[model samples]
Target: MAARREQDFHWAAVDRGELVVQQCRQCAKLRHPPLPRCAACGSLDWHEHPLSGLGRIISWVILTHPGGKDAVRRTGILVELDEGIRVVSNLVDQENAAIGARVRVEFGEPGPQRLALFRTLAETPA
Candidate 1:
């Protein structure tokens, strides 16, 4: 999967312990989950820009199902970064989470793969 040219930029950054997204050179639009062309300007040329590692929890779900090897209770969270892009990652070391909570991105090396996770800076609920 790393051989895909479109995802190379994202995986390359994640491999180095950083979060990045595709930015269109023409319209200055940012695209995540990397695409072949910019949806805003239809430009195929783009670059990767590192994020601030700051975000806010917009929504989340905790899975309690059991699995084979890596089956553990995990919280899947949707973080809206300060840059206006939303990334889907897991909440590490958190038993519960709240919406609208402030969060920060953290890179984790779980097993042989590296992943981006979020931790709530403030678990404020309204």
Candidate 2:
């Protein structure tokens, strides 16, 4: 497969335990899955803006497919970050998750690389 080239700047931040998004220098719009040019202004120049790593679960699903013995079940969630960008990551340290549940980021160094994972915040009794 061909290299993406855009996530280069993004992974650098992830390795450092920080999540960043590309913001167009010309239009000031933040973009995830970083791209080379701005969608709004088509500006090549941009900056890496750090995110708060706080978000809510917009949606989620559990994966139980076959991936050999090494396959551990996981929940993939669409997190709507506080900065307004929606990110796809795994929801960990919990049993079942719900839509609209708040989450906080947790850095995981699974191997040589680091990734941003999330955990559900404790829900208050209503």
Candidate 3:
């Protein structure tokens, strides 16, 4: 299946300001990076399971563009959600970006497209 068709549900959910994981309808197993079939049960049936939007940074890296004047630096992270599903997204604020740092997902500023980004829990106001 084409990538867009397989991930339409996920991107749509994100656009609605929610995060979701693909769950195997038959086995009830959860997976990210949506797929046409479940790896665990080999079932093509699945549903979008809304996530808590909570996770911890497991790893991260700094990406730097090579262009001189137009250079840009962004932090890319791998987050392991509370549900144990891992998601790859950009770090929004990039403060307190460390392994095991708790984070929450937030959508990027409104634009032509929105993205799932993360910020450290500590940075969030109580």
Candidate 4:
């Protein structure tokens, strides 16, 4: 785990095919984009914990001209995890993204690092 920041741990976890978040050991609160200290209680004692990889789409944007072909091929979403952490990542395994959609975290190769992205879970036919 040669990560410079807290989010680096999350990225590292994703690289290992796991979803993790920063949890304050003192306050037992989860934090995203990992901070040096817990925002809830200013606790520097923290640990990385695995998440369920389930979340709902809170916001999203479609990039028509994302500066490159690969960028344009993907869609982005801001997902609110069940633990209350919101992460902005690309949505995979789908053709389009929609609001209020249920999503799960997935690992993908995006540049030199392993990245986490959201993939739409298959919907049960109504």
Better of 3 and 4 by TM-score: 3
Residues 1-126 of candidate 1 have per-residue lDDT tens digits of 446678876777888888999899999998887899999989998988889988788889876655444455678888889999999989985665888888888888755778888887754644
Instruction: Tally clashes: model 1.
Output: 0
Task: List lDDT for all candidates, in order.
Answer: 0.83, 0.85, 0.86, 0.79
TM-score of 1: 0.86
RMSD score of candidate 4 (Å):
3.0
Best by lDDT: 3
List clashing residue pairs in candidate 4.
none
User: Which sections of candidate 4 miss by over 4 Å?
Assistant: 1-4, 64-71, 124-126
- TM-score for each prediction? 0.86, 0.86, 0.86, 0.82
Write one digit per residue (lDDT tens) for candidate 3, span 1-126.
655688889988888999998999899999988899999989999988999999889999887666653244678999999899999988887767788888999998534688889989874322
Worst 10 residues of 2 by lDDT: 63-72
Residues forming the 10-long window of minimal summed lDDT in candidate 3: 64-73
* Residue 109 Cα positional deviation in candidate 3, in Å, after optimal superposition: 3.5
lDDT string for model 4 (18-98, tens) is 988888899999888778998889989999888888888887876566465554366778988878888889888556577
Our model 1 lands, by Cα RMSD against the true structure, at 2.8
